[model samples]
Target: MADNILRIAIQKSGRLSEDSLKLIKECGIRFDNGAGKLKTNATNFPAEILFLRDDDIPGYVEDGVAHLGIVGENVSEESARDVDTVHKLGFSRCRLSIGVLREHDYQGVSDLQGKSIATTYPRLLGQYLEANGVNAAIHEISGSVEIAPSIGLADAVCDIVSSGSTLLSNGLKEVETIFRSEAVMIASKHLSDTQKTLLDQLLFRIKSVQAAKN
Candidate 1:
């Protein structure tokens, strides 16, 4: 909570977690991350790292509980928090897609009219549906969205698609991509002058690391 130190939130465990940690180390920020530790202080940089649920990262940054966060763009937009997406990490790339039963005569998004779609991302799904002028019922569920169709829980599903293997295994076929997502750095709007300067330095290092890969 010090004005001079930046508090960066990241997913504790998920596809983005390792990439986030690697980026920080690449930025020359050293810290002891003991196993199961929820938080750690950077030994070289004026920052602290808070490991949290990916879905909660944006809200923590928006509330200034953490000065910054790295999360998927899908989660950020779905959370609808008032945090600034300062940079795109360009990793943990995936898409939010709509899928239907493989046996169904799937034609297009228009075929979803009046049908119920299960998803963890109701907001994003709703937006995509509205933009396409398609009307459907959105059933928000916490997890196991892909199995919705099999159990008769819903007619279709809106979920994250990485390699499309999961969908195929679940007897569903991806029909439409609603959102493309990758890891992104988000900053709190209430950063102090000192914190902002430190963030700039950290970003400089990150960019340098990224440049070296080319």
Candidate 2:
């Protein structure tokens, strides 16, 4: 491993991982991620890969644990982590939304007053509710927020809705969208001169690859 190598954080599993590796390969950056490994060293470039949860990427970058990261914009914004969004990856598009039972007569945002809402993104949800002057209760769940309404944990759920299958399966209807999101590349505030040079090269390759796709 190079002493001045750059470290890039990426999701270990789920939707974005395969595409992230594919983009790296398309950019001629060769690296091997052995199964069940938390970190991998790139062979063709001075870079290391750190596998982690997508939600944790922002913090990793902000803390300088990883020099850069690929993460969803929603997670990054929700975390309120101090980092720079270098580029948009144009994948994993979704919406942060307020969802409720299909039968509920939710005419407007004001209707949620005093109601309990379950969400993974409590900070974002709380900000939205407060802005709308809706004094709803926000229940913070790590995951499976969609089931909160069905199981009576909350009257509604503020969560990511993609394809609407999960919400449909859970018998919830999206009432309002809090934010639109997609995958983005982020970098830490502090970078050594060599690290910055390498990152610029990587970003150039990424931009070329992204442009080719468009």
Candidate 3:
């Protein structure tokens, strides 16, 4: 037998995980979210929560494995999954910015021509560079993008910036903001009638909680 309860995916760890759990708790969905659990069934609501990497949430929802997901917009956009964003929760705010060594004499994006860049988001970086008509070698790296310039791996780097602290520590300065992002709620494109009704109920609760916070 299959469970009819809705499944929601959230970040296993990182900036979005704690807040995602808080949102579910605020929505009155009581569940045992002990440490190290991958999935949990709600005791008071007809929902199941799955903890996973934020990067994987978009695909999971798009594939209908999860009915809903909470993830950062940076990930959602970069992944380009077919899921729909139902709500933009005003938290985990950040921006994807182009950073260079603090000593670089950068006047504008044009200065990046023919320069090597390191980033995890190659697609997003490529689109921005193409739109600006700047040609730069993109060195795709999974993490520690800020260290690229220091290690002679790249002339500039594109990465997420919240407070500019990480870049500062790496002797880099943010020169341009290419993308702004925050936590958002995404849903599967296809939903059954029953699933839609349940989704409506969940949305109502989320809206109510958000309204109360404001």
**Would you list the clashing residue pairs of candidate 1?**
none
Best by TM-score: 1
Where does model 3 exceed 4 Å of error?
A: 1-3
TM per model? 0.99, 0.96, 0.97
Q: Could you tell me the lDDT of residue 85 within candidate 2?
A: 94
Error of 3 at 209 (Å): 0.9
Ten-residue segment with the worst summed lDDT in candidate 1?
A: 201-210
Global lDDT of model 1: 0.95
Better of 1 and 2 by lDDT: 1
What tens-digit string does per-residue lDDT give for candidate 3 at 35-75? Answer: 89999999998889999988899999999999999999999
Model 3, backbone clash pairs (residues 3+ apart or across chains), number: 0
| Residue pairs whose backbone atoms clash in candidate 2 | none
The alpha-carbon lDDT assigned to residue 148 of candidate 3 equals 89
Q: For candidate 2, which ten residues in a row score worst on lDDT?
A: 1-10
lDDT of 1 by residue, 1-214 (tens): 5799999999999989999999999888899999999999999888899999999999999999999999999999999999999898989999999999999998888999999999999999999999999999999999989999999999999999998898999999999999999999999999999999988998888889889998
